[model samples]
Target: MRHLIRRVALAAALLAPAMPALAQETLRLRMNGDVNTLDPISTTNFTVRNAAYLMFDTLYAMDETYQPQPQMAEGTEISEDGLTYTITLRDGLMFHDGSPVTAADAVASLERWGSVDGLGQTLFSKMESIEATDDRTLVIQLAEPWGLVLDALGKISSNVPVIMPAEQAATPASEAVQEPIGSGPYRLVPEEWVPGSVVVFEKFEDYVPRDEPPSMAAGGKIAHFDRVEAIYIPDTATAINALIAGEIDWIEEVPADMLRYFDGVDTAEAVAARQSGNSMQLVVNHLNPPFDDPLVRQALQLAVSQDDFLLAAYGDGEDRYLKCAAVFFCNGPYATDVNTDRVLERDPEAAQALLDEAGYDGTPVMLMHVSDIPTHDAYYAVLKPMLEEAGFTVEVQPSDWATVATRRASKEPVADGGWNVFFTGWGFVDQSNPMTNVYVSGACDDAWFGWACSDELQQLREDFAVAETEEERMALAEEMQRLTHDLVSYVPLGQAFPSVGIATDLEGYIESPVPFFWNLQRVE
Candidate 1:
């Protein structure tokens, strides 16, 4: 009788309903590639910008309309002469470490950022001094009225002016920061990080989000998740399957061929983030050649086709990519088709003749390529045979995009670990105006990665920066675009907006060129 009672009790216990699982407020997502570092100053790519943004706050932020908005700053007072400016920090601000935010931190951050960034360097030339008058105020005295000061500070693109603690901001420009501690809403959980696997972030309880509403990178940034885990699933098929199978929450990239998979799924939805679209450009090292010769550079342009690259990178469709000739972006206000005919034309014989006139040497043209980015891989894959067919000795150097980024910075010759050409892309904000477009700046050693130098181009960009009226600025921009095509510092391949996949449960996600983890309220 006792054995029968025991069996009946065990069966009743097993049949009882399972206890409810603990309620979770975790956000699970993936990136196109692993972020290099959370260090705000060590800005390398778009993925890094989106990640570092949660850890640091800029003094000023740019809105969707490309206007500067006050963020951490109480207000900025500019002199009537536009040569002097005073900035005050918000009250009761503190870093993730519980230390008070100070003006000295802002000064140090700006000085460090100015030393490395192309636009920051430009602004620094005009900045005579950045002095901290008090614990909360910084005074920037300029040599002249620089028009792009706030724009540089508020820039949302790479090499962003992300503020950190004064001690941390003191980190060398050549070095990445050791820790991610800032006054931003999210704090890094170092213990949870698994490099090349997953990284975790937790909301800072002490964070005081601004009372303002959310906009692009500007306004109040309110964190909705208690924890965010950014997982890295390298396999393209596995990531899409994981998203579809409910194993992952979101995907920052969707391989062009798999766009149809998300059509009928009710549990998942794919929406385009960073919808401003990005354009791939060919960046060539001016330090070495056959590419060093202007004639060779121009000759390289004639043999290639943007359509070939675009069709391969994106899916089959004419609407997938725009044949953009403007380096600044075809969609922006600065766009001009002045020398587009030269870009659209494909004449290998004419290209060969130009190469002949330039006295084409058999110098090996090293094309540093990345296999990870589909578009870049597509473009370079097409460019290799095209350049070879054009009678240039081409050596395709295959590397991950991150390594390609590091290698492209070398000043040595290709034989001595330097590269002749590399691939990179930019969205609208980074290229919209002459002020932020470092590729066209022509600052010689001080220019963007490729180090293209032209004094005339420099003068033109500077003139556009200080132009008194829109008409004057537009004229200078048109001239600059025309000059860029002729210079061939970089080839504008094509343009297209890419989409990101997110769970339908995640709502209130804003449409931005840079992804934001704020203002999103979860639903069951």
Candidate 2:
């Protein structure tokens, strides 16, 4: 598999004859996952969403500072009541298919999202209604005041909401996934999808660039890469080797342990970005025994030493820990203070006392992790011993990533009848609002550990949504975080930092919290 990935990487580096060299410099980014679909609504997986972001445009976008910026919408005006918002559209914007982008298109795009079956329906469900006044103006009426509506739209999941041609969306969902279209820098060429091989994006020269800056952009050139290629190279070792060999210009999701090997390689430049909102933590199923008691959860949190896990997984580097307070480091709105002094110090004796007091006397516990994420395995290897020393029988179950996700979704008890603890990561649309991703009970189907819903937490989250000011919202968020910390639903493990290996020659490549390939543009 490694050898096969190396060959694909090499093939991608050689400029293809089919594309014109004069079109502009094309940067081929070799990634670890498959770019199988152009349909953004089909899946919220980062891999798929990252590609759609390059191929589509949303009403709002996030700038480098993680602030909301306008995209397709020229500007948005909110009424004093804050219930009605009027958005003016940028003029002359056209889809890849050359159709003029209009308020009708925007309304259609939003309506599709409002569908319960849509990938982003959860986000737009709060909208009261959308009305199109003209080709370039949209009016959205909300049920109540939503201060973060623009911020919410700028989310990678929401901002890049795929704009499907009304004609195509009329087709069945199955066909839409196969023949996806959008208004972005590139168009999907289905012929490029070779079985288990490369998926190519052909440049759309007639593509309309947004006249108004996206809500996120202060000011700059729009997307510069004329064409983008996403070649799948599944093996991390081979991906690194390809970068060193100059067979591939860049590789995302670099393995933590192997970062040292490419330290001074002339062809490779190690671009370290704050972890892409990927977080690894231990979740305790509250419905099950042992973990059913908050005290038991607290005992487990105290027993596992975060320092040992960080050292074992990242080998003593500051980059291993995100400075932000959110589960994922770079993107959240609030700045998090890493309580290193408190987090690193393990209190096993105290943990034992807590467990004993809670009536947990050497009860066997199950520790589950997906085998695909190498870091999770490293975490468990270090954590198991700490937990065992605290008088807990630790059983480890490693399985495929998909199977683990299915199990989590089923909300079924682990195969050993029930699991006291499990390891998993939570993915968010953006970093600014960490509360919704981690603590908001119903946001991601269920709580992190499938814990029973809390009425108080739900009320707090609602308060956060309607907060008129940042101070009020943050105060509520802090309270919510404290509640989760006190309840001990899961141990707040360190966030994952994204390590990118790029060719030094590449310029204008800014590292975003949600690492996307389109964010890079060759400067030379």
Candidate 3:
């Protein structure tokens, strides 16, 4: 029935006259939510990170083959002891304000970012010092050898290591920058900036792109469009309509079920923009009651069925999603299923027994639901019923993602405006390994959102970090997975490759975990 309605609407929409093109080349994109901040260091929100990809450039980036390549740096030299790393900056790098990018800016930016980012903190923990010896040269002295030095700098997702002006980078990591300044291909139009409605960016004429062909977030970032508009439209149907009518050029996230509507349409095409996709997860507050008990957390994990959540969110396309038990990404190295039978079993009877054994007395679990995003709302729809059937008192707290992002930070009880559980998605890059994966950290008070504390897990991560051989790392990773299941740090629902809809006339789309706008071009 849904397909029939979409088919009819799409046919009629195709018959309508096409809208005239703008005088200036402009790409209007549909954003999931409002981009309140351009400061990448302060938050790990996807929307902001997506926008940041265009507004800022990284020193190093992951290429199509997943190997790190220097972007801003001309080259790097390492000492025989593996302690000293000297990097030379490429020439012609200038910020939006027409100021040349320098090594001092990189040092200050890294210092502030390392204070907050999950991977940065780990990398900085073993660091001795970072200094800019000259205008175009910077040096880093490490206390010990580390494997993920490039990985931490070249990470392609949330809390991205984006460069900024020295003065702006000097701002405390706790506070967001009031203004965003970078040497990327695009510059934010401050005069046209609107928090919720829309945000505008213009191509930087003085910006010099790399000579190499664009690959993932590396190489060239050629901005084909003169202007780019990230327009926020909460309604999925309305956003789709806008795309079909030529009112918008790209829909960042296209629901899996609606991909069929563009089957024979000439105006638009649906592409799997993110090849690796995101790992959808259900995170719980370890500090809160019921969840504070490991038994209760184990029970909740037992109640979940990855298939139910994936089907509800992504429809019946096998290519769209995957059901895997690995805490680290299922496709990557060190992926393991040890002790994941608890998640795969999905026996309601067993879940009830665990809940009973845990002495759960119908404590109302606060599940935060985000209605603005279609996929998230679908996951919420299936999740609430599963909890109820599993012998738990569930209270559905409906709200936007911004509210959930802010509320999840509170360590207070649910009765005191704190939340118990919420669903979020992490890109494969963010979950590929123990060091890069933020949610797996068992740093207690210093851990990411959930605050799950386990010295055993921490020790395993520490061991995994410095493991000399791949076999040793794999063995340590397997142990960590086993401990993760035992501790029920968080539930990994499933993995999904989300589709993006774009105008058929638009070309040069780069397929990556995160979408990029630089090389995209419009065809007449």
What lDDT does each candidate get?
0.77, 0.62, 0.84
List the RMSD of every prediction in angstroms.
7.4, 5.2, 4.3
* lDDT (C-alpha) at residue 468 in model 2: 78
User: 1 or 2: which has the higher lDDT?
Assistant: 1
TM match of model 3 to true structure: 0.93
Off by over 4 Å in 3: 1-24
Kindly list the per-residue Cα lDDT of model 2 for residues 1-524, writing each as its tens digit: 55765566656434333654652366666654566556655443455666676667677777776677777777899999998989998766788777888888777776665452322344465578888898888888888776667765655542245566766555443233676777776777666654235666766777656544332232222566666767666556776787777556777666678888686677787766653545656776777667777788778777887667667777766665642334324445554443333233578888889888999866567766544455666777888899889777777776544344335434455564455665655444443464336444433343443554567766777666667787997777666666656665567576666577887667656545555554455554
TM-score of 2: 0.77
Reference-based lDDT, residue 296, model 3 = 92
Which one wins on lDDT? 3
Clashes of each: 0, 15, 0
Models ranked on lDDT: 3, 1, 2
- Could you arrange the candidates by TM-score from highest to lowest? 3, 1, 2
Answer with 1 or 3, whichever has the higher TM-score: 3
Q: Write the per-residue lDDT of candidate 3 for residues 351-455, one digit (tens) a residue.
A: 899989989988899888899888989989998889889998989888887678667778889999987899888888889878878766788987878888989
